[model samples]
Target: MAGKSGRRSENRFIRYLILFTWALFCLMPILWFLSIGLRPRIEIITPQPIYWPSFSLDAWKMIWQDWPMAKYLFNSVAAIFGSVLIDLVLAIPAAYALSRFTFRGRDDIAFYILSTRMMAPAIVAIPIFFLFRNLGLLDTIYALMLVYAAINLSIVTWIIRSYMLDIPKELEDAARTDGAGDLRILWEIIIPAVLPGIITAAVIAMIFAINEFLFTLLIASTPNAYTMSVALANFTGGSDGVIYNAIALVSFIAMVPVFIVVLAIQKHLSRGLTMGAVKG
Candidate 1:
């Protein structure tokens, strides 16, 4: 018994160590970005990466001052929110239905939705471009929003449905017994029970929407509607078609919102991710 206990303890320690190492590896690039962003532009582009900061915000200031940073930021905000809103409005009820009831062709319907994600955005970009052009949405924030929503809808629905399934049907049934209707049950009971999951899905969807580049590139024709991901690409162009320091600075700016959200809600994300890994 003593030996078994010792082995278990050793295994736990080893597992923790492995996890810690993996986390550090994942975070290394982010830390490097921070370090680079803070350093002098000259120091950042040196043959060797500077371990210490020269302690300057010049690159960041220059990026904000020289570029339409505000416009890019606004575009990103608009795109992320619009996409998330569309996804949630459509996905919540769909997820609830899929989770709470059985109906004809249910698995087929779910599979159809999931299968949309398998299509590459690049493959469909030209058609979307033409479609948006005909709708008079070309070079507009709305076009970016629509494309992002369409692409992200499948993921949001799939994720939310899994979380919905983890919620006990008995709870909703009890609400129904007490005179609650479907809408009431969803609004008051089911939604609250799965709020964490909803938040997790929203955050993930928002992150993906914010970071999306290809669709943004194809759809947005003007700087007014261009997202940071697109704007960042502009930094690497010229006869000298690559400003290494500016790239670092722009990249850093782009990652801040995503990093903060992920760090803040990481626990919820972990829980939501595990929601449907097992049957109740």
Candidate 2:
């Protein structure tokens, strides 16, 4: 009994050590970035860095006053929200159809939808650019929002459909017997049942839209439509040269919204991801 107790304690110690190491690995960059953002340029550029650097808010001030940070942040929020809304509005019905209906070529259509994601964005970027340009939609937030929605539509449909399949048909059938149409059944029955999966899909879509760089860079030409990602990229080269501290501050600020969103919906995220893994 003593030997067994010793083995269990050793196992616990090893497990905790592994978890601590992994946490450090994940947190080290964020801590370093925060440290940089708080330090002055003099301390940041020194060959022998200060471990506990003196704090400064100059970077935050520079970003707020000089950079169009507010506009970029607003654009990022608007674009991501629009994309997620469009994705859900379109995906829910398509996913419901895919899940509940049995028409000819259904499998083929599903495969085709999923196949769109396999194409790299670069492969289609030029065509999309020209298409937007021809439509006189270049350099607009609407264009970016539409592109993001289309890009994420396939994955959202697939995820929501999987979750919808896990829902019992009996509930839908009972609703149908109560004189409910397909739309009513979906609105009343399936939507409530699969809401977690919808939330998961929306969160994933939001993250993708938020971090998207190439499309935004290629499409938006003015500050009016520039997102946080594009604003961060502009710091790469400037007339005054790159300021590492300022860049770090911008990076930290850019991540705040996504962090808040993940924290808010984490419970739903966990259940949503696993709920569709196995069908009932």
Candidate 3:
């Protein structure tokens, strides 16, 4: 028993060590970005690696004052909320129906929906551009919101469906016996139980929407529609040379909302990712 306990302790220590190492590896880029973002431009561009940098706020000031950062932030936040709302509203019903009911061509329909994700976005980018252009939605926040929602719809549905499938059918049967309708059951029982999964799906949708650059680049021509992701490009070009510090600031700005969201819902998110991983 003593030897077994020792082995278990050693294994647990090694597992935590690996996890810590991996987490640090993933966080290195963000740390480096912070390091570069807080420093003077001279230190950022210097060939030699400096152990420490003199903190400077010139880049922060330039972005907040000189650039229309508020507009970019508004556009980004609005688009994320809109797209995620649309994704949830649309995906929830599809996931519930697919998870709880069976009908002709149901499998085919689910497959078709999932297969949309397999289609490369680049192939449809031009067509989508022309479609938005024809609809006069180009250079509008609505265009980005719609595009982001569309891109994430299938995955969101599938993710929610997986979680729903994990729910015991007996629960629904019991509810039905007590005069519960589909909508009532979904709202009262299933949704509450699967809240974590839904949050996870929303997080996923927000992540894609926030980080999307290609569609925004093609559809949103101006700053009013383009978000923080594209705003980084403005720092990389023109005769003044690359604004490395500005780029770092933009990267940090883009990451903050997502980071905050993930941190706030980390408990649910951890459960959502693991407990929601069963078959659909």
lDDT of 1 by residue, 107-205 (tens): 899989999999877889889989998999988999888888898888898888888888887898899899999999999998887877788889878
Residue-by-residue lDDT tens digits, candidate 3, 23-78 = 99999999989888888898977888899699999899999998999899889999
RMSD of each: 3.5, 2.4, 2.8
Question: Estimated TM-score per prediction?
Answer: 0.85, 0.91, 0.90
Q: What RMSD value applies to candidate 2?
A: 2.4
Q: Candidate 3 overall Cα lDDT vs. reference?
A: 0.92
Model 1, residue 88: what's the lDDT?
93
User: Each candidate's lDDT (Cα)?
Assistant: 0.84, 0.90, 0.92
List runs of model 3 lying over 4 Å from the truth.
1-24, 278-280
Error of 3 at 196 (Å): 1.3
Candidate 2 pairs with clashing backbones: none
TM-score of 3: 0.90
lDDT of candidate 2 over 1-280, digit per residue (tens) = 9999999999999999999999999999888888998888778778995767899988888889988899999888888889899999999999999989999999899989999999989999999999999999898889989999999999999989989888988999899999999999999899999999999999989888888999999999999789999998777796967788988988888888888988998999898888777655
| Model 1 lDDT on a 0 to 1 scale | 0.84
Worst 10 residues of 2 by lDDT: 271-280
